[model samples]
Structures are given as structure tokens and as C-alpha cells.
Target chain A: MNEAITTISVAAGDSVETLFRAHYARLVRALAVVAGSQEAAADAVQEAFVKAHLHWRRIQRYDDPVGWIRRVAINKLRDDHRRGGRKERAVERLKADARPDQIEWSNGQDVTALLAELPRQQRLAMALFYVEGLPIVEVAAAMKLSEGAVKFHLHQGRDRLRGVVAISQEQLP
Target chain B: MSEFDDDRMERLLGAAGGAFPDVNTAYAQVQGRVRHIKQRRSMIAGTAACAVLVVGGAFALGSTGQRSNLQPGDHGSLSVDASVDTQSTPATDDTSAIRPSTTTAGSGAGSNGQGTSSQPTGPSSSTAATTTPSNPATADVQTYTCAGGTITVRLAAGALELVSSQPAAGFALDTSTATATRIEFRWRSSSDDQSIRIDLIGGVPVRKV
Candidate 1:
């Protein structure tokens, strides 16, 4: 009985640690695109993981624990934005640090700047769908929105980016 | 539009993500943060338990003192009643001898009531006075001299008000670091830029330059 109990405890610990190792980097990168600052996104993701660790006993029972962490991180980002000061400071740092070489796209376009032009919800949906490669259902779960709402936001975001690209093409000499 | 298809969108977003961070380092940081959070929570819980124990102990002591003090008054009142009963009895030889005893008992009872009543009232009145200043509506304004002028501070309900004698520019309160007991402020004056900290010590705001 003692050996079995020890094994179960070790398994639980390993599983949560495994989840953290698997998803931390991808979540941070995807959130950085939405948050406009790698630092802020990393902070939010770390805070979410900390909370997940504290509540792992209950959270591990969930069908998708990563979904819970994503939701928490996104909510933290939203709260930071609503608070205004920290998010503004992060965006300022992003603006100051952004260089042609630093954020240059392979296609020779500033995709980060383009995404920044999209509304917050659309930007989040687009980043999760494309950058993170999450399905609409998972994106909806993370965003706490319906699948239809996620789809609509994705469609609108695509159209907006397309229009921006076309306008830039028209202006080219 | 055709060029901006799903594949292109994916590639653009993927490229924009730059480089993936080191998972091991991030995991280490997360573990550190978790440990910090747990430490803070435990400290808070410990402090709260200590506070409860202190308050509970004080309350228990206060009640015990009150009961002990009231016992004398109760016995005094009973003795006074007994004295009255003795005085009302017929003036026989035995009653005459008990008259002096009854009078002494009555006077002792009067003094006990006076002493106990005075003892409880003194602390009660002081307690009331001490708590009155803690109420924001009744709080007094505190002033401190700065480089150029004096800043008067008033504590309101969940807010702090500052009034400067001289015109100061860039007066800003750093609410981000505001706590129940301390708040920081910064402002620019003709002399130079100044910063001040206000600490709520014993329910009174004290200015620290």
C-alpha cells in the first residue's frame, strides 16, 4: 500500500512537470504575439503556471489542463491591459526595442505590427489559431468564447489583414 | 487574397513568434515563483493565526478581568442589601451590637462600588477616545514641510488627499505601491523634484520625506 501510494504521488508530480515543460515555451511565444511584449507574455504565462502548480491536485483532474492554464494566462493579460500602466509600459518597451532585424519576417513583412492593428479579440484569435496552431474548439475554450465566436473573430481578422496587405501592395512603387 | 491563404497566414504568424525560449529555465522560474507564492501564503496564514490568537487571548483576558471586577460590585450590592435588612430589624440588645457592623459593611460596600465603577469607566473612556481618531471622518489633518512648501494630508475613506501650499508640478501619487499602511508620492517643485512617503502609523498618517 505504501509503495502504491508513493508511486501515485510521484506520477502526479511528474505529469504536471511534463505538462509545464511541453507547453510553457509555445504558450509564451503565442501570447507574446498577442501581448506585443515577450516579457509581459512570459510573465503572464509563468504566473498562470504558478497558479496551476498551486492547484494541481484539482486541475490535473480536468480534461485539458493546458486549456485551463491558457485561459488563466489570457485572463491575466486582459487584466494587465485593463489596469493600463503595466501593459502600456510593456508596449512602450516593445516599441523602443523593435528593430528591422529583430522583428523581420521571412516574407519581408512586419507581422507583429500587422497583428497589432487588429482588435484585441481578433488578434488573440488569430495568434492562437495560426501561431499556436490550436483548433477553433481549443481556441474557444482558451478564450472562454463559443466556437462560432472564435470562427467569426478569425474570419474578421483575416479579412482585416488581407485589406492591409492589399493597401500596402497598391502603394508600392 | 489568394496569396493570403491559411498556409501563408500560418507561416507569417510562425515567423513572427521569433525564437522559442528555453523550457528548462522557464520551468525553473515557475518553480521559484511557486515557492515564493507558497511562502507568502504561508506567512500570511501564520500572521493571521497569530493575530487571531492575540485578539482572542486579549478578549479572553478582558472578559476575565471584567467578571473579576464585577464580582466585587455584585458582592458590594449584596452587602448593602444585607445591611438594609439588618437596620430594619427591631432594636434589641443583639441588634444594637450588630448596628455598628452593618454600618461598616454599608460603607465598605459603597467604596467597592465607587472603585470598581471608576476602574471600568477609565479604560472604557480611553478606549473610546483611542478608536475615535481611527475613524476617517474624525481624523485630524497632518502637515509636513517640503522643499518649497508644506503638504497637508488627510485620510478619507479608502483615499488620501494632499494639499500643497506652493504650486507644485507633476504631482503624482504612486498608487501601484500603495498599501494599507504606506503610500508614496512624487512631485516637482521650483526648488527641485521631491518625493514623500506617507505611513499610516497607529491610524495616523505620518509623512516621511
Candidate 2:
């Protein structure tokens, strides 16, 4: 991520486009886990990128423009969730059309479903810190929460996952 | 369960965020949305500008029309008041002689009689004559002498007010013909008969036989 930001800093002329091309895919994927729908996540990231494009002159001067984009995307998602109707409809559609051929990283475990079980804040913190490989501070900034809050969410999420794993193991035996 | 640690969680979460379905199409869509927003803002700004221009143009045209209709004698307050008061004076054989008398009375009255004479006396006398045709009221008394008696008419609140009549027996005011712009008073007796038609055209009275 720092490499991508450095590349953007070096090529200031087309920084917004460069940043979009570099980070758009990763951000969409991470937000998909947080949003629980690929389409909704993609839309949020696209809106964020559009905003970044409009305000690039000010955004390009920031320490991390991608962080700004991430924050905007997260905020968009949060706003959509607060609207209730759209988020519920999107969740219902996602559940109805649950795809079985998702590429797994841990022996075919459904990581998206596992993360969905966590609370909204914990889910976002986990996705940003682990999936997006961001530090606790960046996660806090993107989530617009304090670093201590992000840490607590991360801790709570980890404990929840551990309990799920323990329960699965016990069921298998 | 021991193997399910932070590294495992990172790997699982990272993998759950699969590759984007379509990047090129999305970038194009974002650019399109930005252009659309710009077009909408420009349209709103253009509409507001046109509305302002239309209102300003109407006001300017109205002002120009009012100025063009104003008579040369309508400039001074004294002359305007005198013209309203003495509009009912009978037209002499030489009509040009009436202009000097009207100006002389207006200038000679000074501060005593003219001040009290300028005020309107009718029940509805708030409005006064001006160059603007929008307000057509002229709340000054006008006296016309006919063969039978003298009739007084005053324009107030877009209607003709009959202030007084000396004998009221022979003179008959046609109420249907009375308006802010025109009035007709007819007097008939055994010896004399006459009709006085006073029309206020552009705040100046024109007597028709």
C-alpha cells in the first residue's frame, strides 16, 4: 500500500487515475466482506473514487489519498446501512443468490460468511486490518473511530472467531 | 482451533475480498457520473440567469414606457395640480389660450391656496395621477359649466366621484360611462342643453364636444 502511495507521489500528474487503478480492486474486495455483497461494495468504492476525482487537487496533497478513498467508501457504506431499506434488500438478494464457487484462502472455509456473523464495527475493523492489511491506526482513521476502539473491536472479533472455531471442532469430534 | 490464529484470519479475510468483477467499466461509469453532475449544475445556473434577465428586461421596458407618456407640463408639482383642478374649464374658440391661464394659476398660487387645493377630497382619494398608467386615479376636483348648472367630477380609486352640482335638477351623471380615464355629464333644460365628456388620456384631460 505504501509502495502504491509512493508511486502516486512520484507521478503527481495522473495521481487520481493511478491510485484508482492500483487500489480499486483491493478496496472493492475488502468492502465486499464488510458489505456482504460484491455489487454494493463495488458501487460504494466507485462513488468514493468519483469523489476523489472531483477533489483530487486537495486530495493528492494528502499523506495517504487511498486512506481518504477508503474512508469515503466506508462512510458511503455506513450511510447506506443507516438508510435500512436498501441495505436490507441488498442483504436479502445476497442471501438468495449465495454463490458456492467462492475462492477460499483457508481450506474452503467461507470467510465472508464467518466475518458476516461479527458485529458491523468488528466486521469493518477486521476487514480493514486483516483483509486490507492496514495498521490499527489506518483502520481507525478509515472507520472514523479512535485507535483504542479499533483495538477493542479487533480483540472482540478475534475472540468471537476463536469461539466459532472451538465450537466447530467440538461438533466434528 | 489452535491453528486458527491472526495469520489465518488475515489470509481468510484477504481471500474473502476477491478480485473485482470489472474495473474498466466501473472507471468509465464514474467518469460519466462526474460529467452528468457538471451538466446538471450548468443547466441550473443557466436557468437562473435567464430568469433574472427576463425580470430585469420587463422592468426596464415598463420604466421606458412611463417616461415616454409623461407630458412636458407634467414636470412641476404646481402645473400638474393646476391641470387636474382646472381640467373641466370650457374650451374657448381659441383653445391655445387655455394653456397660459393654466400655467399662470399654477405659478401664482404660491404656497397658500395651491397646497390645500392639491389634496384629494373624495372618499377614495389615496391614489393620484402620475406618468405611470398603472395607477390611473386623479383625486383632484374638476368643475365643468354647462347651460343649466356647474358639475364637479373627481377621479379617485379608479372611479369617478361627483363632488357637487349647483342645481342637480337638469344635470344627469351617466354612472355607466364613469371610469378612471373618462366621465360624461349631461345637462338639459327648457332653454339650453349640453353634454360634457371629460377623458383623462395619459393623466391630461381632453374635452370632447
Candidate 3:
């Protein structure tokens, strides 16, 4: 890994280095929400960006290269989950490793548990709509679902989260 | 009202994704992987070019009735093509090749079918452009709902054509050239009956070509 060199060559507005810097952390965080583990999320994003770099010569030609990167990274995380129980195992590790002092713990295991409980597309809708700050229409666009479907997922995701969080709070107090 | 409708739920959902450590090392880590993949890419490209040269030479020899070295009965293309592929990835090779492993790992990825699609054992990555054998009849088919439109590429039937795009909400797969994004480009390799098919999505090569 080289030091962050100021990219001397800029073709148009999008550069590989520029995209990486701007979205690397954001992608890691967003995918952690989807994949439920910071390490795995980072791994997926790193792998995705590596592909982006591999195809950068042509990828830079796209209208939304960063969006393409995001889609690939998210799909990688999704595929990682589909491949096996790695993310679930990671979550179990999260619960066991919770120190009550860490940010994940502060955020509440219930959040992770509930997020996992949501169906895949619904979770994706939540991640894009809330975590990544994409508007509803854009979230629909990103997920390749209809705007009605996006709204549906959002509604279902919120309804599920509310019910679960309320139950968690009652048990806490 | 939905749970997320409330401010408390909003705060929690917004904070769902946790922070990562050592943010500074991230770009470096990604860059390191990029370098590794690119090196491997160049190696594949070089090996493929060499294979083409060898195959071309053998074909030139076999055409002449007196070209004794090539087996008179067996076509030169098949034998040479097999040899070329066999050299790239040994069946015993570990799954450490990250680019192919990453590109072909899941059921759905936009492109890079060019390299490391070990299942069919055809050429991959940039080498796909040059390594189309003529004898392959198998069709690799897949349907993906990308961005706005549904993109499907069915290979071997004919020319690279868009199967269907309804509402065509987003992304376009144009086979006119290699630089097309949101479009899947299918290239048929020109080695007689043995051909390689490559699918590129958003300018990234997908499963095979």
C-alpha cells in the first residue's frame, strides 16, 4: 500500500485515487451495516475497489463509476452472506465480544439483530435510505426496485425496527 | 407510525453502521490489492499473447500438406488451445488469485468474466479480447436487474445482442465497443469452432468471453 499521493493525472473529474479516498470509509461503514461486521465489510470493499482499479481504464468512462463501485461492493457483501454463514458467525462473535464500551455495543446488539431480521431488500433499502443518505427514489434506483417497492421496504423495515426496539427498551427498563 | 418514523428510531438507524479503526490504512490496503491484481493481469495478458502466437504458428504449419509436425488427423486449434489454457491455472491451484476469485465469487457481478472464471476454464480478463477459440458451443446465460433495467446476455446463439430492456430504468449494454458501461459486451473468439465469450458490464468484463 502506497502513501496517499496526490493523483497528478486527472482524466475528467473522476480519478481512481479520488474515488477510493472519498468512498472507502463510507463504503466500509455502509457495508458493515449490511454485512454486520466491520472486518468483513472492509474486506468486501477492498476487494471491490481492487476490481474497480483493475477496470479503471474503462470504469472511468462510466457516468457513475462510484455508483458502480458501490453496487459491486454491496453485491459482494450480499454474496458473501449468501455463500455461507460467515457474517452470522461474525455477528455471533460480535455479541460474544461486546464489551459494552465499544461503539457497536453502544449502538446496541438489538440494532444488529433487528437489521439482520429484515429481509434482504428491505435491509438494503434501509441502508441506502438512511445510512448512505440516498433519497427514496434514488434508493429505489440503486436497489433496482420500483419506488413503490422502496417505500414498501422502508415501511416494513421501520415497522419491524419499531416493534423490536420497543421490546428491547421494555426489557432494559 | 413506523418505528423509524420516531426521532429515537431515526437516531438508532442512522447510527447502525459502526465506525472502523485505522482509517488511514484503508486506501493503502486497497491500493496494495490493486497493484497485486494489475500485476497478475499483465501476466495473464502476456501468457495469452504468447499462446496466440504459438497457436497461429501451428495453424500456419498445419495448413500446408507437408506441415508434418502437427498431427494430420487432429486439428491444430483444439490441441494448442487446450495446452494454452492448461498452463494458466492448474486445477490444483489454490483460490488465492484474488481478481478472478473476487470477480467470479458470487452469483451476480457486473463484469470481468474475462479472467479467472475457472468453471469453464476459458481465457479471462483483457486476454479475452485476443483469445477467442472457435470450437466452443456452450452457452453461458444470466439475467440481472441492474440499476433501472433488466440486463440479460445469452452467449453462443449469435451476435452479442440485448435480450430485453423494459422500462429501461437505468444502465445500457452496448456491444459496439469495449468502453460501453451499464452494457454487457459479449465477444466471440475467432479460433475456428473453438471460441471464447466475454461479458463486460459497465465496461468491466463479467463471467466469460
Candidate 4:
């Protein structure tokens, strides 16, 4: 973490422009890991900033605006996926697993293709938990799921990823 | 151990995530939109002021020296009291004479047949209303545009006209003032709304007040 990050712990007196520049990159990266597409992640973060600005004066009084923004960004991501359809819902399930395979591959290299192989929910669970490093509570808030459900999705997602990646590796070697 | 518990996995995902683009430009884009919205709000405000002055000048000239008998709900009318803070600079209208499309409302006159014949027709049904100029925003016409739509207002002829530039997805209007009449038209796809004001200055539209 950069020295500037410690300042994020307490959100007082920071100009919107300054806070935006400092955390924008990290937030995008975090969202991209769960969003599956760079463009979607960027959009989600952008929306978060807008919402943050709307409530900036009041939010500056909080202990951590970054966390508040992240929580909001994650929720936005979940809402977008929900609006997309059943397939998207499944991917969100996978992203909760906190597993790396659930999130890697947006270089247009075959990440999406690989991800397509897992149940959407499992894939989403893995991506959010492992790639984004968000706690289950935060993930639940972002995913709009109960903690028990997130746990279930993560557990099921890890098993599924283990199965798929193992089979693929065996076939490769 | 998890299948993803490997350094290679972290490196690959980390690099890919790191590939995410800078959000400053995007943020700036939204900020630019905010600024543009502010400007449009001022313009709409200025236009609104112009409308008021134009309409008010006509009203003042038409009724020259008569005492206003405006009472509460005398003819099913409502009142609008606007209070604008001076902290935000008020908008002024540069174009005073050119009003947007004003259409005549052909509502029937009362049995007494006084001055109720030329009442402005709109979505509101009640008549005989007195529209006090939105001080600061003492105009009869205002215009607003956004990615979703374009709205133009002309009050002297007593109607608000709106044109959608793009198909609308949805919309909503929650104005506090109930004194002025309102008419709304919508298509099926746009959702954004911009604000512009017209101000009446010395019987001629002026720039931001």
C-alpha cells in the first residue's frame, strides 16, 4: 500500500479531486477482478465516484470514504449483473469464492472463455473473494446476498474451480 | 490448498487487473457533465426570467393600474412562491423577444364571461390563477437539454413544450411550485433532464440575474 493510502483510513478534509486520483486506479483494478470486463469495471467505479461526490460533504465526516465508495461500487456491480440475466447471476455466484481463476484473464487472452466454463455464481464468488480480497460481509453487501448464501456460493465455487482447473491442467500436460 | 493458491495465479490476475484504465478522464467527463448541467440550469433560469418579464410586462401593461383581486382558490387557482438564494448567481436572458412555441388553450369561458376567455390551457384543469413571476426567475419561457431529451417552455401563450432528442427510457417531474400551469409530453426512452431559466429584466430579457 502506498503512503497516501493510510490517509484513506480517515476521509476528512480531502478534496474530491485528490481522493479520486489517489484511489481510482486501485478501485478499478479491484472492480475489474470481479466484473470480468475492464470496461464494466471502469463504469462501475465511475458511478461510485459520482455517487460519492453527491454525498461528499456528509461522507467527509466518515472514517473511511474509500470503503464507503468501494461498498457502493460493489453494489453497483451486483445491480448491473442482476439486470443482465440468469447467466450473469451465475457468474456472480462464482465470484464469491475468493479464488484467482475466477478473476484472471481480461487481457483478452482467454480469461472470459475459461470463466465461461464455471457456473456464473461460482465464478463471481471466486473473483470477488480471491481476486478482490473483499471480506465476506463486504462481498455480501456488494452481491446483495446473505452471508450464508455467500458462504454457500464460495464453498460451491471453490469446489467447482478446483474440479475444472484440475481437469484442464491434466488435459494440457 | 485452493487451485488458485499459487504465485503465478496472483501475478497473472494482478497484472490483468492492473491493466485497468485511468479513471481521471472518465471522472472529468462526468464532472464536465456536471458543469454543463450547471450552465444549462443557469440558462434555463435566465430563460425563465425572460419569460416572466415578457409575460409580466404584458400583464402590467394590460392591467395598468388595477388592484389585484387575487384570492386563494377563487377560480380553482393555486399559488407559487419562489425564494432564490443569492449565493448562487442568477441567470439572465440575452434573447428577450423570441419566445418558444406558444399555443392557445381553447377552454370555455365562465358564464359571467369576464377575462377568463384567454386562460392558458395545460395539464392543470383549474383556471383564473395568478402566476407571480419567479423573482430572479421572472420569465415565461425556459429551455433545457440533456443526453436524453430537450425541453422548451413558453408561458405567455400558456403552454410548455418538450421535445425528446433521444428515445426515453423513463422520466419524472417533482416541481414544488403549483401556481404555474404545466403540460408534459413524453416518448418511450429517455431519462435525463437538464435545466435552463429565463429572467425578465426591465421588460427585456437580460443575461443571468
Candidate 5:
């Protein structure tokens, strides 16, 4: 997508700062949807970009560098989730950051609060499909999940969020 | 669109992944570490070559000095002097001849009494051992008594060397940690070479080839 990617692909002649500035925020946001924590999303996206830059010589010829990075960030999210042992800490962290009036969510207001309550698989599938804009097949592969399972988690995740958000909206003045 | 359909979910899934890291710093860190490892390897190779030269030179000088010290008259004169002093004395019986006489006498007197017979049988028992001619057909360990202690070495199929030692009673025998060579032993010696049996299990040397 960016000319800097081609420049970095050739040799030490390229400046990586240009690529970092261009895609850094988008990559982080895409990863944050998959990864629950802001700090973890930042770290995972940064690591993905760093890996991409090192392999840019080969990756430049590919049709989509952004897709490669999204895949990397998704894998990193899954790896981090597994290493965290349990989702309680990640959920608590998300809850702490989501003050309802302050932090913004991708979907809408208080969406982070509803997402934090979802099972990890559901949240991941929903995030990849909607936030990252990946096709269902790609999302399944990225998540190391079957297509049926991904769809099931997505269905369940959306229903739960709808129930929570609607209940909150009805109670509002 | 329905209130909670695919469109609603898709809208909810919006921009969440964050920006990527500073790519330059990460690349530089990896490159530096790799370069450092390569430099360390080359330095180690140079040091090894220098060590070989120093050891070779020392051995050559020591051998030359030993050759110089051994003049024609030196060893011959010492043997000649020893023979002259022993010429008048009566020849003593070899220990082999006297061993069997003591064994036969000890066995004839005692048939029982383990502790009672063992008391007087100590010296006589050792004397009995020298009578049998040593069989060279089978493997036998040669024992050497040095100033530090006694050492028993059995010759087998491979080369062995004490590459490095920390001079401790329980120091582990190891090659270099960088290399995947290691050795472990169960026994500990309180003093140098103090009554140790270097059991060559399956005839393997206690060193890396």
C-alpha cells in the first residue's frame, strides 16, 4: 500500500520510520479489536511491524502487506491470550480502561464493556470479522478455528452484546 | 438492518488494533546481538590457536633438556655402582617363592572362626596373593602410588584427558558449556587420587573425543 514498504524491501537503504508512522495507528487499532488490552494491542502490532520490516525483502512482492501484518497481529493476540493463563486479568484491564464517557470503542459507546464480558473465542472472532474487516474464512484461519466455530462464536458474541447494550440503553434517562 | 444483526456487529467491530512499534530499534537490536555472537566465536578460535602454540613450544623445550641430561655414562654408571655394592651379598628368595608356603600353613591351621582367624591372617593373606602368576590375556588395572595418592588406570579403546579441573572434591567434569559435551560421576574423592576406581563402563573414556 505505501511506497515506504517498497523502499524498505530493497536494502538497508530504506527508512523504517516512514512505514511505522503510516500504518502504526491502523495496525494497533485492528489488533486491539482482537486483543482485549490496549497495552497488549500496542505491543503486538509493534512487534508485527518490526517482523514485517525485517522480512520486507520477501513480503514486498505479496499482494497485501497490511493483510500479512493483520495475520501476524492476530497470531500474536492468540499467543498472548494463551500465555495469560486466564481471561480474568484481561477482562479486568479492559473494564478499568472503559470508563463509558472517556475511552472510545470501535462499535459504539460502552461496546468495550460488553466485549470484555464475552468469552475469549467469541470476542476474537467478532473483532476479526468486523473491526479488522477480514473475510470469514481468513478470520477462521487467523484464529486457528474452524469456520463453523468462528460463526458460532460471532453469533453468540453479537447476541450477548446486543442484550447487554439494549438493557443499558433502556435503563438510561 | 435489524437492531442486532450483522451490520450492527460489523459496526461494533470497528478500529481496535493499535499502531505498530518503532521498526528501526527492533531491527538494530537483533543485528547487534548477532554480530556480537560472531565476534565472540572468532576471538575464541584465536585464543585456542595461541594456546596450542604455547603448549607445543613448552613440550619441545622440556624434551630437549631431558635429552641433554642423559649422557652415555649417566644411567650406565648408576647401574654399575648399584651392582658392585650388591655383588658380595647372598641372593634373596623372590617374594613369589615364599608366598605359597605361608598360604598353606595358614589354611592348615584354621577351618572356622571368621574373626579369630582373620586377625592373624592379614599379612599372610597378602603374601598368598603374590604367588599366582598374573594372567596377561585378560584386562588388568595397573595401580600407581603417587605423592598425592593412589591411582588405578585400565587401558581400553579410547583417548582421555583431564581437560580442566577446578581442584575441588566435588567439581563436575565438563567440557566447554558452549559445546554440547558433558560428563557426570557419582563418587567423590576426599584427597587427591585417594583410592578411586575409574570404572570404564563399556570401555568409554571420561573425556570428549
Candidate 6:
């Protein structure tokens, strides 16, 4: 996150507004890639931030407060996956039947679709590493994986994405 | 070859990220979610409070309906709460607990030794109760009960005497409103000097009282 940082008194329970201002959009975009839908990602991130606001006293003391928020959002996505299959199926069905323009297609390639071929942990590592641009330790913290595991997933994820990138380039119109 | 790969991979990843539509109302979403959480918590608190009140109210209403045990020798120990009037002497072998006294044939209207100061020496109301000869006509009188005590309202002969657990204070017939099948009266006691009216409905009293 090379975004500008405004200098102010940093304290626990404070900076929620500042943190939201800086990272809310980027968090939503990154989570949308992870969740495969803008709608679900927005909802998940909003709820996670709501939780963060409640526990801001503790959360703001963390080394990476935005990383904590991302972890919460990711956990929420996982929970929705486990609890209700109907909503997940409905979203997939909507995407399948929705109009072409209604869908957000990358001009180059769909990185999430490409990452879908990788293992879940590897895909998550890549998203946190590249899309959200978190460090290895932060990614490990967010994923609740060890730093070494994050490194391994990142290595494997990059190796897989390399193949995907070459293929998409060859298929270019 | 490197992280975020400056050439082909970077461009591909950036394109994918760029495709994500901007959500302009991020703060609005946070506010909405926070409000929703607060509302859900309050609703749960309100439901719990209502349940407690309902349970406590039911307990209070039920607690007073118990018939107190007052033996023959316990006359001096009789204590009456005007609110509950829960204190009473238990019915002896001579008095059937289930079969309440039901006398409605004749009261020569002469000897009522325990008459109230309100109608002093006119008719010994307590004596009228004792002179009630046990007869089959006892089947005609109906007993109505409330939260406080039982008031046996009977239209016997031409008069109505609402003999309560307390002999001194109870309802008397408002002769102007007495009918063959129904009886209406204006009763006034000390603590509850409010005029009482009992509308006998299907052998039970059901009203705002």
C-alpha cells in the first residue's frame, strides 16, 4: 500500500476513520477477487469492518490493522461458504444468467478465474501478496498460516500464474 | 519471474483489479451494518425483558389463589390483607372444602346477631348465615372466586348476602337490581371502597374486577 499516509496521533480505538478512508476501496476490490462477486465481497467487507469498529480498541493496536480487517472479511467468506449453500448457488446462478455488460470482465484476463485452478491456500496467498500487496508476514497473519507456508503458497501460486499468463497472451485476439 | 511481476503478470493482475467496480458508499455501508447490529441487540434485550415480566406477572396472579388453612382454634390468628385476603381458616370435617355453602330457601329475616354498624341491629346478618338450614336447594347457589378470596353470591328467598371469608365485610343485595336469574349490586369496602359489580357469566365471574 504505497498510498499517502496522513500524519496524526495514532492510538488504539482511534484511526478507524483514517484506516477506512485509506483501505476500504482496496479491501473491497481485493475481497471481490477472492469471493468471485462484488456484491458478496462488499457485504462481507462491510460486516468485517463493522466488527473491527466494535473491537477497535484491541484491533487498532495491531501492527497491521488493515490486515486484521482483511482476515476478518476472509473468515466471513469462509463462514458463508460453510453455513448456507443456497446463497452461494444463487450468486453463481445469477452470474451465469446475467447479461454480459452486467459482468465485470478484465480487458486483459480474469486473475481470480486463473487463480481458481490453484489450491485454496495458494490462491489466497497470491491475492494477499499481489492484489492487496501485503507482506509475507502479514499474509501469514491474515491467512493464519505460518510465514514459511505463505512463502511456499506464493511461490507455487506465481509458478501457476506464469503458465496462465502465457496461455492467455497466446489466445489474445 | 518476480513479485507482482513488472511485465506481463503485473499488467494482467492490474487489469483484473481495475475491472472491480468502485463502491462509493463504503462509509454508508459501515454505518448501515453498525446500526443493524445495534438494532438486533436491542430487539433481543426487549424480548428478554418482556418474557421476564410475563413470567413474574403470572407468578404474582397465581400466588394469591392458594386457599389458606385456618383451623377452628386459629380465629385470633386470622390476618387479612385487603389486597390478597389470602388468610383464612381451613374448612373442617363439618365444612366441605369442595362443596361451598349454597343456601337459598328461607331466612326468616329475624336473627342476624353479627350485623354491621352500617345497618346496626336491623338483621343479624351473621345469624342469618347460621340459620341457613341444610337442604337440597343448596344446589341452586353458585360460588364465584377471585384473586383475593371467595365471595359466595346467592339470591336466596328475596335477599342477597355475599358472605365472604371475612364475616364483617362483604357485598349485600342492591334490591333494585336483583332479578330471578341474575343479581347486580354496588358493594363498598374499606381499602377497596370502589363500587364492585359482579356479572355472573356461565357460572363464573368474568369482568374488569
Where in model 5 is the C-alpha error above 4 Å?
A: A1-24, A58-68, A85-90, A96-110, B1-7, B15-209
Which run of 10 residues does model 3 chain A get worst, by summed lDDT?
A: A1-10
Taking chain B only, the TM-score of every model is: 0.32, 0.31, 0.28, 0.23, 0.24, 0.29
Which residue pairs collide in model 1, if any?
none
lDDT of 1 by residue, B1-209 (tens): 21223876777776656578888988899899989989999999999999999999999666534422322112222233333333232111111111111112122222322212221123233233323555532233333333322233445543444322222333332222244566554556444555545676555454443
Question: Model 1, A38-85: lDDT tens per residue?
Answer: 778899999998898999989988767788888999999999988885
lDDT rank order: 2, 1, 3, 6, 4, 5
Better of 1 and 4 by lDDT: 1
Task: After superposing candidate 2 on the true structure, give the runs of residues whose Cα lies further than 4 Å from its correct spot.
Answer: A1-11, A92-109, A169-173, B1-5, B58-209
lDDT for residue B91 in candidate 3, whole number 0-100: 21
For all candidates, state DockQ relative to the true structure: 0.23, 0.27, 0.20, 0.16, 0.19, 0.26
Mind giving the per-residue lDDT tens digits that candidate 5 earns over B62-85? 653443222221222223223323
Candidate 4: regions farther than 4 A off: A1-8, A62-64, A75-109, A116-124, A144-146, B1-18, B23-27, B44-209
**Model 6: runs farther than 4 Å from truth?**
A1-10, A13-15, A54-65, A83-109, A170-173, B1-8, B19-24, B61-80, B83-209
- Assess the local accuracy of residue B43 in candidate 2 as a C-alpha lDDT between 0 and 100: 100
Regions of candidate 3 where Cα sits further than 4 Å from its true position: A1-11, A91-105, A108-110, B1-7, B65-209
| Candidate 2, residue B206: how far the Cα is off, in Å | 22
Q: In angstroms, give how far residue A135 of model 1 lies from its true place.
A: 0.9
Q: How many backbone clashes does candidate 6 have?
A: 4
Ranking by DockQ: 2, 6, 1, 3, 5, 4
Maximum-TM-score candidate: 1
What is the Å distance of residue A49 in model 2 from its true position?
1.3
A34-82 in candidate 6: lDDT tens per residue? Answer: 5656567677888888998888878878776777788889988878867
Error of 2 at B160 (Å): 18
| Ranking of all candidate structures by their TM-score, best first | 1, 2, 6, 3, 4, 5
For residues B1-209, write the lDDT of model 2, one tens digit per residue: 21223776766677667655677887899889878877998999999999999999999666534432222212333334445554332223211111111221112222222222343322122123222234333334455544544444555543444444332365443232455666655556655555656676544444444
CA RMSD, predictions in order: 23.8, 15.3, 27.7, 21.6, 18.9, 13.3
lDDT of 3 by residue, A55-102 (tens): 888988886776777788878877877787688677656556543223
Predicted complex 1: DockQ: 0.23
